[model samples]
Target: MIYKVFYQPKPEQVPVRENTESFYVEASSEREARKILADKNISIEFVQQISGVFLEYEKQNLNFKVEQG
Candidate 1:
């Protein structure tokens, strides 16, 4: 499955609208996805599972790229 992970790049910084960034990751589950990113120095905001129409729509975006853990 694919998950859209929203996070702040700096661990010490609080997440703000403009400062937050997102990426797509392939993982078996949300917990697994979090675990995969555990070592990265980033503050996670949310891990959302996306599929169907939502996934298709995201794929159309120019910035859409899935990161491999």
Candidate 2:
């Protein structure tokens, strides 16, 4: 199964990238993904676990969109 990992930087002062990112791995769960990110020392402001592959789209000054495949 594919999971779309939604992440925002921990610092609100930092600008977010236009497109949300997805990382593919054979992990069993969403928590595992979070753990992996944590072990890598990547700080996240927010995250969501989504089903299937997704296309990223951006809306200015609003939440990013993840379109599931």
Candidate 3:
């Protein structure tokens, strides 16, 4: 299954944990994902696995039609 890992860097780093990030990874199970993070030694203040996610539309598709009252 695909797991979306959201994480924040260690507090001591220049970029604090406030600015978080997420990435998709394929793993057999949640435990496996955790192991991967451990092996990589990523100091994360927070972590979560997202079930699903939606991406923004393309630049050209950003425009939308609406009738103003």
RMSD of each: 0.9, 8.2, 11.9
Q: Choose the strongest candidate by lDDT.
A: 1
How would you encode candidate 1's per-residue C-alpha lDDT over 1-69 as one tens digit per residue? 999999989879867979989999999999999999999889999999999999999999999999887
Poorest stretch of ten by lDDT in candidate 3: 60-69
How well does model 1 score by local distance difference test? 0.93
**Which residue runs of candidate 3 sit more than 4 Å off their true CA positions?**
11-17, 45-69
Residue-wise C-alpha lDDT for candidate 3, range 1-69, written one tens digit per residue: 545565654535555545775555556776776676774545554434444332222112333221111
- TM-scores of the models, in the given order? 0.93, 0.39, 0.50
RMSD of 2: 8.2
C-alpha lDDT of residue 21 in model 1? 91
Best by TM-score: 1
TM-score of 2: 0.39
Off by over 4 Å in 2: 9-19, 41-69
For candidate 3, the lDDT comes to 0.49
